[model samples]
Target: MTGPRGRVFRTVSELGIHYRRSPACGVGSRSPRKGPRAGDRLPDLPRGLQARSSGPGWHLLVSGPPELWPDERIALVLRGRDDLVGVHRLGGESPWPDVVQGLVRSDGCLGFVARGADLEGLRAYLERWLPAQHG
Candidate 1:
């Protein structure tokens, strides 16, 4: 399977391209493939995140506060872990700059978040507030 047919992302600027991985269509990984093996890109969503999507509009139901994930970053997250992802919230001091009182806007937007006491609380916030749009 190694050939020019495969997609390859080389630089930061080219991250937007569809080269690294492909999409998966399911609730979770079917058979749980082997280590570092080629298989469906999107992994199974941890029970935590799967609960959030029950309501509406792109709710990031992970184990942390993905409170403000921009559209593009979401794309990045979706491209791979279209199922369940373990997201972490960056606080008072991280690489991203604060865009809102409690949210930070990173160069990418796979997941955006708010400040919370712990990872669990942050996950709750993301499930509570994710944007919805026309895919």
Candidate 2:
């Protein structure tokens, strides 16, 4: 079936997947949502934590207790990326208990989510999506 924006879907599940994966679809602002997911816009940052203007790049938001923080390797990779604005350590409360890191696109949409400060998963995501040359 033809879905919104002229995209075709084989089933309702496909349509739901598309909706969950398309940040431009404006699903983040809608009601009856479960919680933030990849493709949803990053939720408003807590007070005193300003989001940097990434221009056309991405931003990494890391939250959780210090014991679950990202290590130096991840920091170095993010620091070397031209496509990444920088890593922002989120303070205050977090809505996601499983997610420790989020990758926010320049459009303010979340492109990836990492649980338990999983650096390997984060590295793989960067390699697949951002790539080294684009960094």
Candidate 3:
């Protein structure tokens, strides 16, 4: 419904289809955009997975299957959850994010990301990755 960033944003999950622009509309290339051209970001660099009603309820990108493990490093955007345990708030309306810097990696070991609104759920997940003390 809005074009605020280079990344045209929309939520698609079967139960019919919703898009940022009309299904027939097209997003122009960066050449039409402003500023020095360093090229657009690699598509799906900040990937996400969500629960849907129909279509592909669970979508995975070309990042190869994500680690999908607890406390794993990620670039995420959650919307809050009452049933989730360790989820947290990370991203927001800013297309080029400025909130959480933890998503960036110096080593590139980071793979995929998740989006949810369950802060407590994420906390519980991080706890699982904690090291154990053997006797």
Candidate 4:
């Protein structure tokens, strides 16, 4: 498949290569265990969440308790960002074990993962990857 930049990708996995970052880049570490990681296709979300995950642009999935979710400040920072499709709150039964937050690419690949309430990490990842929308 050819991407918007006219780069030819031989497979669906290759489609997200542009979004992948090395561990040194501070996105997420590639682990030997089986689980979500940067560049890995996002695992199946719950039926309800899957329906909402569809659309253009990136999607933010926040799990864990409400207190751990991104606060108003983060929300304000993300406001008006055209690259962001929407934010969906995942329930405790989410497939991604021990993950508190995840950034899902438009092509259904996991671009970033946060295991803790690392709002700063999320902010940084977005800043480095997605372009900010200017008025």
Predicted candidate 3 versus true structure: per-residue lDDT over 43-65, tens digit per residue: 23233312111122111111122
Identify the leading candidate in terms of lDDT: 4
**Candidate 4 residue 113 C-alpha distance from true site, Å:** 0.7
The reply for model 1, stretches above 4 Å from the true place, is: 1-83, 87-93, 96-107, 129-135
Candidate models: Cα lDDT each: 0.29, 0.55, 0.24, 0.63
Poorest 10 consecutive residues by lDDT, candidate 2: 24-33
Q: Candidate 4: misplaced stretches above 4 Å?
A: 1-34
| TM-scores of the candidates in the order shown | 0.19, 0.60, 0.19, 0.68
Better of 3 and 4 by TM-score: 4
Tens digit per residue, CA lDDT, model 1, 17-131: 3212322111121211221111112122232322323332233322223455444555553443333333333332232233211221121222233332223433333344432
Error of 3 at 30 (Å): 31
lDDT of candidate 2 over 10-104, digit per residue (tens)? 33324234234463322112122234567665554443332452456777777666556646756655644654556666643554554366677
All candidates: CA RMSD in angstroms? 15.7, 9.4, 15.7, 7.6
On TM-score, the leading prediction is 4
Give the per-residue lDDT of model 4 (tens digit) for 3-108. 6544543344353454446542235433223346666666555545555775788888877677666557557658668456578778575656664677777877
User: Model 2 compared with the native: what TM-score?
Assistant: 0.60
How many clashes in each candidate? 13, 1, 15, 0
Q: Is candidate 2 or candidate 3 better by lDDT?
A: 2
